[model samples]
Target chain A: MAFRVVHYINQFFANVGGEEMAHIAPELREGKVGPGMAFETAWKGEAVIVNTIVCGDSYFAEHEKDAKEQVVAWVKEINPDMFIAGPAFNAGRYGYACANIALEVKTQLGIPVLTGMYEENPGADLKDKILITPTANSAAGMRKAAPTMAKLALKLMKGEVLGASCEEGYMPNGIRVNFFEKERGAKRAVKMLINKINGKAFTTEFPMPNFDRVEPGKAIPDMSKVVLGLATSGGIVSKGNPDHIEASSASHYGEYDIEGWDALTAEGWETAHGGYDPVYANENPNRVMPIDVLRQMEKEGKIGKLHRYFYSTVGNGTAVASSRKFAEEYAQKMLKAGVQACIMTST
Target chain B: MVKEIERVGIPVVHMCTITPISLTVGANRIIPTIAIPYPLGNPALTPEDEYALRYKLVDAAIKAFSVDIDKQTVFEF
Candidate 1:
């Protein structure tokens, strides 16, 4: 008997009217709707989409809680072996609905779920919570997305352990999965180095996340009136590390009071960062954060007052995503506190 | 992280030993520091000289806040 799979998609992919039909609510059809045919072909009798759940993008966006409840109820009734949602491409609302519905089914029904979308789709933000295969920016990529999704779906149905994101075609979700490679680490690195020197195209095993450049903020008009903020990834912290920030891959940041501090003494402060030699920084924590010098400038009226609080986190091996989250959270606080300028240090 | 702070409209200068990584990460204003272990201070110097060196670097970083830059820039010390 073929394994049962339940598929979800928005109205446009269900052969329902496009923008005009976007207000339609949730409905479940018997089997094998538009894109389901592609999954069927790829499944090759190993699994069959027993049911298809269709919801309009606008309806889901407007009535998200209700739409999700309805879809989850229907999926529970079907109780398929696995669930799949749209390769929603670049349609924002549809991608969001597909990713959310897939997440709901997986959590509520305890079933495996998969979805696909363009890498930049807002839905891709949920990639850490669900499996999302990257697709092209438009529906034209369906031919490729289908087979890739289907192969992974089949693996999930068979209860097989999955490989790394690069091996399995899913976005890197922060969860590191270990797997064996044919070549040893050193041998593979040497080959990659050779490829690089010869100008041959080579894929990096650890690719840096795409960084968005931000326009520089307007310059402060007068340094004497600016409230300077201090932050660091060099991991300077209170001597006891009261917040207990990890030495590497720090998951959180520490905010400390420096209202009257003139210097970071060896007994009062230390570096929690494991990436570098800690001796110098431990002897004078200001080497990493430079709070002492900033305080001197403040006293001399060279600059306005230093913000009383300093933020610290270890940058050693920290994920870019984690670092971004930390900064976003604190930047809002700094703004509210009237910080006009900031100095950030990293080791 | 420096970029994130800048994204929120706060002028920020990154002081670090590795200027290339700071540039790669899209910091707008950067100040190259002395070394990874002692970015602002040199233990080889007397405490007074070390404090002066750190004061100079921090001063440069403060200067970065007021400089108008259209692209990623390193504020040389």
Candidate 2:
């Protein structure tokens, strides 16, 4: 039996009025509507689209909750084996509606779902959560999108394993599936490094996450009046590392009282970091934490008194997620204590 | 971690040996250091010399903290 499929598209693609018909409520028709013709040709009788859900972009966006429930209830009756939403291209509102409905059908109904959108579409927000094939920024890419989406949709319905995003022409969905590579990791890394040195392009095995860029806080008007707190990811701690923080990949942070301290002496402290040789830091702990000079600044009135407690953690090999957790906890305590500014040191 | 602290609206200056890594990790105000193992003081030098270098670096860090910056600004020592 041919797998039954349900297609979703905006009113514009349904031959309804363009912007003029944008306020129309969702309506469904039996089989092969608009772009469904292209999908039918691509499927080659392996699967047939049994229904197409047509809705206006404007109506869907403004009344999403009701529209979603209404559309979902209707699709539930048809109960397609797979669902396909628009190759919405760069149409923001259309892309958004298609992505949302597609996601809903897959999640709530457990139906195999497929969608396509331009990389910059607002609907791209759902990329990591769905199988979103990449389309061109405009509908001009429709020819390429329909065939690709159809092929993938058929495999999806048959429960066939799919290849990586690059090979299948889809956006990365943040789910990493293991695949064999031609070269060993070390050799690949060496090759990448050599390419980098030669100013040639090489794909990295692990791409760094794009962290949020935080704007710097307003500068202190009078440094002499504000209390200063010290924080370090260099793993400086009291003698014997009372907290036993791991020298590398530290799981926790330590807060210690620096009250009445003139400097971090050899007897009182040592570095708990393992990323580097600990010889010099153990000999004189101030090199990493700079407690000695900070004290001098307090005495010399170069700045206000230092806060009594300082926070420390090991940054080496520490996961960014854990680091965020530790900072969130301590930063609250530091703020409540009226610490106006912070100085962080990392090895 | 420094990013978390600054997100709370408290001004922060990060002093580190690896300036590029610090920037990549999203630090706003940065101060360059001499080495990783000895961020503030170099053991190869005399104690007095080490203290002087440490003082210079810390002073720069303090200045960086006090100065307003619209973006990532590295305070050189």
Candidate 3:
């Protein structure tokens, strides 16, 4: 007997209408519909889409509680071996609907669930909780997305153990699953080293965390009228280290008032950073925070005014997520204070 | 931290010893500094000279804010 599967899609893929029909509520249709056909082809008669649940993107977003209850009830009644919802691509609302519905089915009914979406979709925030195969930013990627989802779905239905996210083509979900490699660790390391030394392309087993590149903000039109803010990951603070920012892996940042200060005298300020020798920064805190030069610039009209407060934190061994959160908090303060530009120093 | 500040639409220049690390972390504006321990100052120099060097670097960083750039840029001083 063919393994039974339940598929989910939005109104756009269901041919119910475009944005005009996106308000339509959840409905069940027997067998594959729209992109389900692509999955059907990939399944190769090994499994059949026993049912498909279609929901409007807007309806799902507006009535999430009601929609989830309906979808879970329908899935329970059908009781398919596996559940799949959307290769939603870049559609934000649809991706949300698919990821959420898939999560609900897995948790509420204990069914294996799978979905796909573009990495930037807000729904991808749930990637760590669900199996999300990355797709291109548009529905044109359906051809590739469907097959990848189907292959993973089939394995999931067969109750087979899964491999690492990289090997299985799913987003890294923070769970480290170990598997045997064809080559031993020592041999693999040697081969990689040789490839690197020879300048040959070789994929690293552990890649650096991918950073999102932000477009440069438009340049300040005139420096003469700008309120220049100063910030640092160099850990310069008051001589006493009032907020007690950690020397390494900082948990918090300090905001100091230098409103009337001209230079950071050795007696007045010091570095909280443990990553480097603190002698120079301690002798002259200006080395790491540059308040002395910025004050001079303010007086010399090189800049309009120096922001009164400076934010400081130690960057040594700090997690990128923590760093981002600290900056997000202080960046809002800078913005609210009418800071036009900023210079950040790191040690 | 520099990237996050710039992401909020505020122009920010990162002054650090390792420009490559700054580039990798997606900082849009970068200024190479003397060393990790004293990014804006040089203890070997006379106080006046070290002060001058720090001033020059800060000036360069300020200038970076007014120059439009489409990609990550290292502002050399």
Candidate 4:
């Protein structure tokens, strides 16, 4: 016997509406609507898309709570063995909505929900664990995502233990479970690099570099009138550097001060940033800190008063959540002190 | 770090040698320098050249405080 499956969707996919229907909240139908039929045909099981809940993008984005609960409730009623959502390609809100719905459904119904998304979609970050397949950037990726999702969903329907995400043609969800038989990332990187250097076909463990662009703000007016702050990722530290900032993904930051025109000397300072060659920083702390030049700038009236303290953090291997929190805290502290501008140096 | 700073209404200028990393990490306004190990003054260059480079990049960074853009803008030296 094959397992029954259900599908979820937004208004655009449901054909109920497009951007106009984006505010349309979740409403379930009895049968396949949009891509659900394609999914139904691709799956091996008696995959029945029991319902299609249509909601608008703006609606879902603005009212995630209502949309998520409604979708979850609708899927719960169906009680299908499997669930699926959009292989959202590059559409930020849609991908996010689908991922959110899929994640919520998996949570409430205890059913595996499968979907696909491009690497660029922020949704992947929020719902990677909820059975997300990596799709290409556009509609062109539909063929690849649809079939791959179907195969994976069918396997889940059979109560199978899924393979690694890459092996299964899915994205790495950042959920690392120890299977007890594998080298660490550092070792794997070394081996693979050696192979590549030797002209062998070695695979890279961490191919994609993680980067997330933040929304840029409007630039301020009157640089000379603004209070300037310094923040460094160059592993700048106090004279003693007590916390021992990691050479990479530094664990802690220390604050220092010089009411006078003193410069950082290697004899008293050390490098804690692990991501790069520490010898340079260890030989001359200014290489990473550039404190010498910044101080000179302050004296020359190129900028307003330098903030009394500079925030420090290591970038290598630091988790995004913690790093963000740290930055927020530092900013809050600076703002409370009347700081109006910042010059952050990254190694 | 730049975003967090700007979130509180303070303008930010990110000086970096790793432009791509900064771009990917979402730095809003950036001023590019000579190198990573030495963002401002490169030890390899003549002291005068190093000072010239550092002074110019820093000048751009300070200038970035006033530049307005609709999207992420990268500064090159």
Candidate 5:
């Protein structure tokens, strides 16, 4: 059976006119339109675009819900084996409409959908949600886009497993795949080094990640009126360390309820922090987190209420990634509890 | 991790015996501890004196949060 496909293009490419014609509602034509003519040439007889659904960029953006439902209803009637959205380059509205409609088409119809857009396109953010072949920055690159989109759509129609992003020329979908290279690590490194020393460019197997530099948040105007929460990397826990967070390289953090409690004692809690000497912190755990003093402050009306629960994790030898994960999770929990400020203690 | 908490907007006064390392790690506010093992108190001091020292540390840290300023700050006891 010839693989049947449905193609989606914006008003401009569908010859519904340019920006002035962008108000056109989505309507299906019998067969290939505009870029689909190029796709037909590329696909040969392997696949045919049985229908072309065209929607105006502005109309689709302003009336997304109605536009999407209308388009999905039409596509459901056509029932193509695969769907293809725009090679929408850098056109923001058009790219957004293409990716948006393509995602719904795949979801409601459960067919493989492919799109193409410039790397910087806002629609590129949807690369993980649907297949998006990398395209040029404008419609001028439609020649390159058509063949790339057709090849991938053809693969999808035939149920062929797609290759890596670099190999297949698509945006990386963030799914990790294991593939052994012909050359061993040592050989590859030597070859890479030779190429680099010869002034030739070499692609690195692993790219360094850029870290976020967060600006400090505005300070609280009045501590007495705000809820205060306590978080610690000192590893002070309730008595036996219920969560069993390791003394070093802790795997998890524990949220202990401290409401109506004034002191942290050696009997009730101890230090799980391995980096520091345990005797003093264990004997008077409050010395580390200063919860006892905070209670005193609350009583003295120096601050509002202390948050009911305190989070504890051991920072000693703990991975940076693990600590970040702990903070991300517990931070949201504290925020939900109305904690406007936090006291983070470390050993 | 102090930097991480501060990054999220809640100001942190890192109470550590090692002040230089705290500043180096980009901790915005810092209060020096009496010792590494027991940051709040000096065990050699009498109970009353120790309480005074701990109170001084916590008071300084909390007070630091009250003041408004730009850039990193260090709170001394």
Candidate 6:
């Protein structure tokens, strides 16, 4: 039987227009949009992209959960055997939206979800778990990626064993594929290196896309009476990470006040950051949150004052969106407290 | 924190142990600390030695507030 496929697209790709039209709500339609049509026409199997549902990046980011649910509900009715979204080049928001929808569908509906992105989009960070195709930053890479993604999608839908992480150009789906490979990782790496040395084109065994580096802000002014705020991801907590910050994948953050105390003790403090070895911090609270030293300075009148509260959150694989939100809010809180300086510590 | 705070137009200074990691990370206006694990103090040293090191580093870090540089600069112990 011919497999049914659904192609997800954004407002721009659906030919709906640009940012102004991004608020276009989720609606279903018969058959594929621009790229979806290309996929259907180019696919090997008798797989037809049954529908293309278009939504804007602004709309999706503004209404993430609703957008996911709506898309899922639509796909449920269409009942696609496989789903594909994007060849989302460097469009961060669009790539994120497609990745989110694809990830949701695969996890909830038990279907294969495939997407593509340039090496620089942060969508790769979140959706590296999905069958994300390796793509160049422009439409130039579209021809190569579409067919590769289509072929892989068809194979996955047919329950064929996909190749190892190194052989496949897609990001590691985090799904372990047990295969009796003729060569192990080291052997394959050497072969690829040799190929490249011989003037033959060779791709990385594990292709990790690049990330856009945010320019660090410039240093603050010099002032005699300024309060410095402290933040740590070393998992310093009061007795317990009472906030239930995941020992490895923490998403929750907590802030506490130390207006009167000279030091934080391990008797009531613990480490919540999962990314680091917590042994030193667990045995002695001062190892991570040096509230004691900061306290001494306060008593000595070295600085004007301490921000009554110190902001904290775990930084281990936490989403960029969440981290930025935390940072913005924390900065605002410090501002409200009249804090002129900050000393955030991350593990 | 120094970078972010500075963005809001407040003066700031960064302090860290003299380590390759700190240098590579491009910290600006660094005040040298005693060690990596405990930047301000050495666990192996006597209490008086540790206190001296912490006081020296902290003093330098505090003093760094008055100094200004266009790019990254490290403070010697």
What proportion of the real contacts between chains A and B does each prediction keep?
0.86, 0.86, 0.93, 0.72, 0.46, 0.11
Instruction: Quote the B-chain TM-score, candidate 6.
Output: 0.75
Model-by-model lDDT, in order? 0.92, 0.90, 0.92, 0.76, 0.83, 0.71
lDDT of 1 by residue, A1-347 (tens): 99999999889999898999999999999988999999999989999999998899999999999998999998888889999999899999999998999999888998999999999999999999999999999999999999999999999999999999988989889899988999998999999999999999887897777888999889886899889899999999999899999999999999989977888889899999999999999999999988888888988888889888999999999999999999999998899999989999988
Write one digit per residue (lDDT tens) for candidate 5, span A94-202. Answer: 8999899999998998999999999999988999999899888988998888888888888888898877777766888997767678899999999999999999999
Worst 10 residues of 5 chain B by lDDT: B68-77
The candidate, 2 or 4, that scores higher on TM-score is 2
**Which residue pairs in candidate 5 have backbone atoms (N, alpha carbon, C) closer than 3 angstroms, thus clashing?**
A239-A268, A239-A269
The C-alpha stretches of model 5 lying farther than 4 A from their native spots are: A140-143, A187-204, A207-209, A215-230, A233-266, A270-347, B1-77
- Between 4 and 5, whose lDDT is larger? 5
True contacts kept of 6: 0.11
> What TM-score goes with each of the models?
0.81, 0.74, 0.74, 0.58, 0.62, 0.63
iRMS, candidate 3, in Å: value is: 0.8
Predicted chain B of candidate 5, TM-score versus the true chain B: 0.88
State which docking tier applies to candidate 1. high
Give the per-prediction TM-score of chain B. Answer: 0.96, 0.94, 0.95, 0.86, 0.88, 0.75
Q: Name the fnat for model 4.
A: 0.72
Question: Which portions of model 1 show Cα errors greater than 4 Å?
Answer: A62-79, A180-202, A217-227, A242-260, A291-301, A304-309, A317-340, B7-10, B62-68
TM-score of the A-chain for all models: 0.79, 0.74, 0.74, 0.64, 0.67, 0.59
lDDT of 3 by residue, A236-261 (tens): 99998999999999999999999889
Q: Give every collision pair in model 2.
A: none
Model 3 TM-score, 2 decimals: 0.74
Candidate with best DockQ: 1
Position A330, candidate 5: lDDT: 84
The collision pairs in model 3 are: none
- Lowest-sum lDDT 10-residue window in model 5 chain A: A208-217
Better of 2 and 5 by DockQ: 2
